[model samples]
Target: MKRRPRRSVPALLTALVLLATCVLLAVSAIQLILGERPWISYDTVAATLHDLRWTDVLPAVAGGVLALAGLVLLLAAVLPGAATVLPVDGSFHSGVARGSYRSTLQAAAAGVDGVSGARVKLRSRRLKVRVDTTRTRPDGLADAVRAAVTDRLDRIGPATRPAVAVRVRDPRRTS
Candidate 1:
């Protein structure tokens, strides 16, 4: 059985705090039972609550912050991110990482005639290819990149076919 990962920081801090509180309460109870002076008195706590000030508000603010922190930790523990896997052509599905696919697409795009370099972003249903040319601004650069990337995608055989959108960037502007 696969075990889910837990958020340890919040849990550990909460446990430590509760343990300290229990120990303090136990000590106070023992002091009272032994007819000794207790660390905290009920009358002082009541007086503080009745005459609340900024210092009293600090505890409430701290509690609120702790609650928010615990809530975020709980959500993170419960809802984990989905694994990104690209299905390739074969009897057994090959898991391709997102970065690997982007790199493959970039290499394919850069192989085009006038392209000096390429940047590829592979989304769920869209492939954005940005190609940079040194000085040669050839016509149909977008079409060339689209075709090359499309052919590569077909060979890769991802589960879903992403629409290839090509954008050509000319770093040095020529008249």
Candidate 2:
């Protein structure tokens, strides 16, 4: 099952700004109708607009800022977000959370002999397993970890099997 990310934050902010503008305009209109002074001076705004020119530095900077903000909002609305869950391979429809999948692979790698610690990173189509060992010479540790992780992946049966890469690090070596 595919899930789309929510774009509520941008939408909510845009709505709030529009609402505030509308409320301000309505209040100003009511004050004018009652023959009371409005919060903003209309004459001053009209004079400023009349004096303003397209080539003015202030107007150019303001226009650029507004265009940049619009471009950002447009991109946020159009771009697709990363998947939160990975699909599992099976006759019945099922999926697995990325955290759970990574943990399972890490456990498999850590269970191997001579491995002091294991860290697994799950990418779109890559599984990187970093193994730490106390043994000074970790000759075949990387291969062992790779095989174990691959076996676990097979059992889990993800829809897309990522390529497994194992790296063995010796704690005693500074380099």
Candidate 3:
């Protein structure tokens, strides 16, 4: 069975906007057909919509649409072209479980302060998460990464010390 596509904030908001747009257009058409004077300003339109019991509806629909657009923009900014399944030089025979574990690591890495992005690559039971951070110098970054990853692992489950590797992959690019 094919899984249904998960509705993201943007997609959902777009749908709501479309529905609300249809309703507004319909209302406008109806008013035009009935020979009502056109509303001059948003205030008048809002007042009319309020009288027609659509005041709350308009705001709610507009807000949801705006919020969804913001979320989509944020995702695009944070992780552009991120693959659903990571394809790197790695071997995790445990299949899906291993992939999930690696994702967890990546999330943990991302949670660290100053870390812009991180990629947790698991291969042959070895784990490596390269941190793309704004650290000006290569001091205490390794320790900080280790501590963050360890804390996250402790919360995840039984503490099995995986071979933890962390390196600052993205330094401040002068160019």
Candidate 4:
């Protein structure tokens, strides 16, 4: 299977690139804001840079090169295919579909009486259910949710195995 990046990864990478750009900009800003020469003194630069010539300058040059490389990398991210957020199992859209399905299940679960919030997560087709429910567990709320989901799955036919998890996020009595 071909490897692919997650959809959010680009956004994340873009953010990282933005952050890198900000850092570079900050460095440039500092360079511009304070144009002071190196405190090493002109004599030091002349003395130190004179004898070794390019050799002594090599280290500083290398450091500058590295910084430039990092800047290039940040710039490359904007160009596409520079860095990809790999998806789990190389199937990003599948994961997104699963996520959306889980969200639907959660909403359905929340509709049950006594339930405040339902957060459902799917692990390889299995449903990990976390429901914020009021006192009494509302009796069989989990079952109801499970049945609804199973029915939907039957109609839709997911290509992966399914598991169900039910948890009570909160249990409180409400009039």
The lowest-lDDT stretch of 10 consecutive residues in candidate 1 is 1-10
Better of 1 and 2 by TM-score: 2
lDDT of candidate 2 vs native?
Answer: 0.89
Candidate 3: give the clashing pairs. none
Stretches of model 4 off by over 4 angstroms after superposition: 1-98, 169-175
lDDT for each residue of candidate 2 in 20-139, tens digit (9 for 90 to 100):
999998999899999999987789889998999998998999999989989988988999765667788888888888789899999999999999999998888898999999998999
Per-candidate Cα lDDT values, in order, are 0.79, 0.89, 0.67, 0.61
lDDT of 3 by residue, 1-175 (tens): 1122244655666678899988887777777778785433446777876676445677688889889878876775465342333323224321124557678878988888888888887754457889887767657777788888878766654223467889886566575
Q: Ten residues in a row with the worst lDDT in model 4?
A: 82-91
* Order by lDDT, highest first: 2, 1, 3, 4
Q: Which residues of candidate 2, in runs, are more than 4 Å off?
A: 19-39, 172-175
Off by over 4 Å in 3: 1-96, 158-160, 170-175
- Number of colliding residue pairs in each model: 0, 0, 0, 9
Between the candidate structures 2 and 4, which one is better when assessed by lDDT?
A: 2
Task: List, residue by residue over 17-92, the lDDT tens digit for candidate 1.
Answer: 9999999889988988999988977678789777877567677898899899778877866785433556666687
Report the number of the highest-lDDT candidate. Answer: 2
lDDT tens string, model 4, 30-122?
A: 765698543334466578656675547687788898898678756555544411221233333433344455666677677777777777766
Give the higher-TM-score candidate: 1 or 4: 1
TM-score of every model versus the real structure: 0.62, 0.77, 0.40, 0.44
